[model samples]
Target: MELFAALERDDYEELLFCQDKASGLKAIIAIHDTTLGPALGGTRMWTYASEEEAIIDALRLAKGMTYKNAVSGLNLGGGKTVIIGDPKKDKNEAMFRAFGRYIQGLNGRYITAEDVGTTEEDMNIIYEETDYVTGTSPSYGSSGNPSPATAYGVYQGMKAAAKAAFGTDSLEGRTVAVQGVGNVAFSLCKHLYEEGAQLIVTDINKEAVRRTVETYGAKAVDPADIISVDCDIYAPCALGATINDDSLPLIKAKVIAGAANNQLKEPRHGDALHGLGIVYAPDYVINAGGVINIADELNGYNKERAYKQVAKIYDSITRVLEISRTSGLPSYAAADHLAQERISMLKNSRSTFLRDGHHTLSRRQLRG
Candidate 1:
């Protein structure tokens, strides 16, 4: 692969390849941008089919983080690290410690947290080497689990979307069809139930579906039937790309907001939603609560402060919808516009400041 060309295409700042023979660590770190501040993202460990695949995943995730952090109004850039191995059987203390040292080598330019296939325990190991890590055990001044915080953000974003689509943010009598009953979705269901929103839920895991049905009084449906269910909102909490061609025509929701990443199968799918007048709370923006909560750890980890910041996701989604209306763009494209606009504004401000600083220095030298 043309590595340099790949980085250039996306304006990636740096890509580091780390290896440790002793611990069998082979990792790639992709830093996509740093205009806002130091890059902050999570490290993911996966059993990728090939090195190229892992590299592509890291680059894609890093770019997504850039937009996620930008739209969430965090002073963080975007970067991601991927360890090429099976998380279940390949994790070891030495491996994480070696990885941590590599992160330390970058100074504070990159900060990492726990991601899929990586846990707080793994982050703790990384923490032992460098402090540029978040999502460690709560005993170490870290926010314990981010699931509830993420759920809260989604719920808030959903309300904003509902306001845009139904002219009322109140979900008291709304019908919400949830496609998964995972930790985050379960918490979201709790919020909706308390707000008097009837839930129709489904999951591949029968036990998970049963739990949601029992606790929140949600009606159980088959996973295949979730998209076509007669509901005001369809919350896809399980898999990515569910909004593809087959499901697009089947979706009956006025608003699509959930915890799943990459909800749109492709960019065009977003346009399809826009054509149908469906209000889509962009996945990364609505699901940024976990990252926001993790980011608060950089300021010494305050629960109240973290949650307060996460609650702003509602405003973020609202702003995205406004941008869509004003720009005549799909909600997904509007989200990208919002993030790019922020980054461009900051870049321009910095450029002007540097130019002014150079003039001041030149004048001072002449006087001297």
Candidate 2:
């Protein structure tokens, strides 16, 4: 299980990988850091095209988690695990247990939670093998799915973006185009519709498209067509990197915010967006609501606390937009600056005694 590292910034650490010969389960776990505390993130199951691609995803996702947690004011570092196989076809009880074994081996240097392709039952199976997972069934006293909370966060963040772009902080009567109508997007569409935003939606799944159309009276468009619909907000909830060079030219939205994991084809794409005057809510910052929910389990699961944390998504998005405007940078670059600022502050605030581990700093000294 040896490999090369991906192109990385100076802020991360590569961790463990496990491949089960018996079940053909391949998982790469990337832990960015444990400086703040234990690295907390999610297990994403997908059919990656190549090992390189999988590694790249794990690395990028893990780094994003670090920023996401830090800027969101969580005392958790970032780690991410990616299982290389189609969750719909390649997943089984044994396969998940194998992954659970991988987490068990980490000894809580990293923790796993729910993500795009993983479900509560999958977490349950992982639970069977390791005590390193969360976001499970309600019987397990966990939030079964974070879609609604995630959607609520996005809705709040979108409202913030709307306020930044327009004077009003409401979605009512705004034209919002949603690129996917999955569980979270479904709730998002309902929220938008309830607020009287005209909804334009697209999905490869016909049943989902029909359902969204029925539920929210959204106009259905092809995925390719969804991006250029000239809406007030463009939400790409399906996948990442939809805002690359070729497609970025056609985007007409004033605000770009969604639940997708990795939206930039490359870091420069952020700059390209900035040049075009699009207000982007960097993927990780806006989508941290789910991770925030799962991480809340560590603190006795207070709904009020979760709500407060989720509300930060709005502030975070607004800050990114503000930075982008003032610095003449893309929202992604602005977010990176903000994250780096927070991390640097954390490092600076640690007293010399605390840094050396010979003496301890008071909480006041640690709060710098």
- Which candidate number maximizes lDDT? 1
Per-residue lDDT over 5-50 for candidate 2, one digit per residue giving the tens place of the 0 to 100 score: 3434545676677989888889989998776767888889898889
Give per-residue CA lDDT, model 1, range 126-222, as digits (tens): 9999988988999998997778899999999999999999999999999999998888899999999999999999999999999999999999999
Name the runs in model 2 displaced over 4 angstroms: 1-9, 354-368
Go through the candidates in order and give the C-alpha RMSD of each one to the true structure: 4.1, 3.3
TM-score of 2: 0.93
> How good is model 1 by TM-score?
0.91
- Estimate candidate 1's alpha-carbon lDDT, on a 0 to 1 scale: 0.92
Candidate 2: lDDT of 5? 32
Minimum summed lDDT over a 10-residue window in model 1 is located at 358-367
